[model samples]
Target chain A: MTDLQITVNGDPRRVPGPASLLDLLAHLGLDARSVVVELNREIVRRPRLGDISLAEGDTVELVHFVGGG
Target chain B: MLVDGPFASLRVTRDQPSFTMTRLGPLIFASMSTTLEPTELVDTPLTIGGRHFRSRLMAGTGKYRTNQEMVQAIEASGAEIVTVAVRRVDLDRTKEEGVLHHLSPERHFLLANTAGCYTADEAIRYARLAREAGFNEFVKLEVIGDRETLLPDTAGLLSAARALVKDGFSVLAYTNDDLVTALRLQEAGCAAVMPLASPIGSGLGLLNPYGIRAIKRRLEVPVIVDAGVGTASDACLTMEQGVDGILMNTALAEARDPVTMAWAMRHAVDAGRAAYLAGRMPRREIAVPSSPDRGMLA
Candidate 1:
């Protein structure tokens, strides 16, 4: 289990990643359908979220969908 | 090159008489501002699939380096709606990410796109999966039957759109800039028609603005300029041409500063809409300078 340093929703958190992003989300309790996921600069497609593994020092940004116009 | 229009036969020269401008100025000005007039503005705060969108800017979740940047860029974009393609998170494993953890459904309107599907059936299957995965009614129905052009297979697109709409899915279709096809999709009860400006990720500006304009003229549903947008100017140009909104991906993600580009895009979308509302002066055959009447008399 490699150590990964990343920020989720702007708060820095240290987690074991080298794990797939899907696993990370599972750890964080995120739903791929309702939220938008961006890794590095590109969007991680909902299907690829679990396939895309995390490396050390990778930054993950999760945008939750809120009610708005 | 041959020019076509009312001025095609005008033997335009630097010193020609200002007859054209003098006669057509008022009419020209009126026509220019006609599109810009507030009354000409289409419906705003457009609602689709029980979701309300103010700016009509829908951004794709792709091609960024970091998640924070994506979030920051998205926040900067001022888009209430965003798109995410559905794919299996793990090709190695069978357990799906279940579409719940990527986004908090309560925050933004989620648009599920069938990006990797090639046929109508594949697209339909994916749409159902997305619905089952909690997408429910909202889906960006993309049926790309081709690989090279990344153009929508009109037959496939039409079939899938009709099927999805029949299945009670609110479909926002991604299509080529073909007026007839767009009409067909709109007539099929699509919530929106997202026509490409050029090819996907080509970064080409509106390849055929006339075609897009034609679609806008005929279609009652929101006409969003999707794909092939390279910069903010491209987005603005589409909005100026009277498109209701824009959906872009690569252009923003590839920028030196994705966040800044997103902000620029927001302003561009607004400016273009404002310009369209204010109407643009018609392109005259010759420059209509505000020269003195005495000079004209000479």
Candidate 2:
């Protein structure tokens, strides 16, 4: 099986084809409970992280709270 | 680590006499908690989005020199509703922990802000991203118009507030001290309207007291003064205007001693609130004699 290139937080990463969003987070060593995942501009609720699979050329954003006023 | 910082000092022995101020801070705070004025008794908890918060002072989690300093200062400030900003996790870095690593969701109600967004759509997008963090739906919405001044674009702010409110997010707008704009935000269904004390980060301190007071007077929602406070006096004076709360960032984070400054702010907020509740005397052109004119000591 060929690897698929996906955009994660604007950086390109290659994962095995049709990897679940949960798999992407686990591959990146991210705690699913801590970060919010945005797939193709739609927010994926926590429980749905593993249900949806990433497609080629998809953009996924992982964001969390930072310091601000 | 139980031997350093104000939090660690919470374990100080009860017998430690002549305890240093910072070393034994919580004891002083606990002792000072007595009610000299029943301001809190009369004032209900600050309610926004159907949630009640005990502390009227909301603090930002940015600009501190170190994360340790940020944690210590925020903890020292006694802020129950703390504001944070949402940003993409830096994937290139070895490890970039989010602010949640320090702040507990159970302790501090996390209020995320759209701090850098300049347009309504951008602010709306940021707010949506923030809501997905699996926290409460409170957002401190800012639509900055000018890069140099960092003043808000009220037009964009109102539109974003309306959009976010429609989507079920509790909007707390960061705007200038303008009554008309604040009223519009309230009409837009914002849970709270945050008027500025001065320009953002100017530390100018309540440039227009009349304007800020007017906003608080007219708006049904909680009015929180969001920026431009430089010191404890600024916090106190801003609170004296009878606003529901005050949110500050640089005033504490940029202080020479953030921990001590946070302590001062907590006191200043309470003092000012109490003074406001007690009510100040009307200004007089001439002084009146405390002793009667007939009762001269001579």
TM-score of chain A of 2: 0.93
Q: Deviation in angstroms for B251 in model 1?
A: 0.8
- The local distance difference test score of each candidate is 0.73, 0.85
In candidate 1 the C-alpha lDDT for residue B154 amounts to: 86
Q: Rate residue B31 of model 1 by lDDT.
A: 24
Q: Which candidate comes out best when scored by TM-score?
A: 2
Question: Please, what are the lDDT tens digits per residue for candidate 2 over residues B100-119?
Answer: 99888898899999999999
In model 2, which regions exceed 4 Å deviation?
Answer: B1-42
In candidate 2, position B240 carries an lDDT of 93
Cα deviation of A48 in candidate 2 (Å)?
1.3
In model 2, chain B matches the true chain B with a TM-score of: 0.86
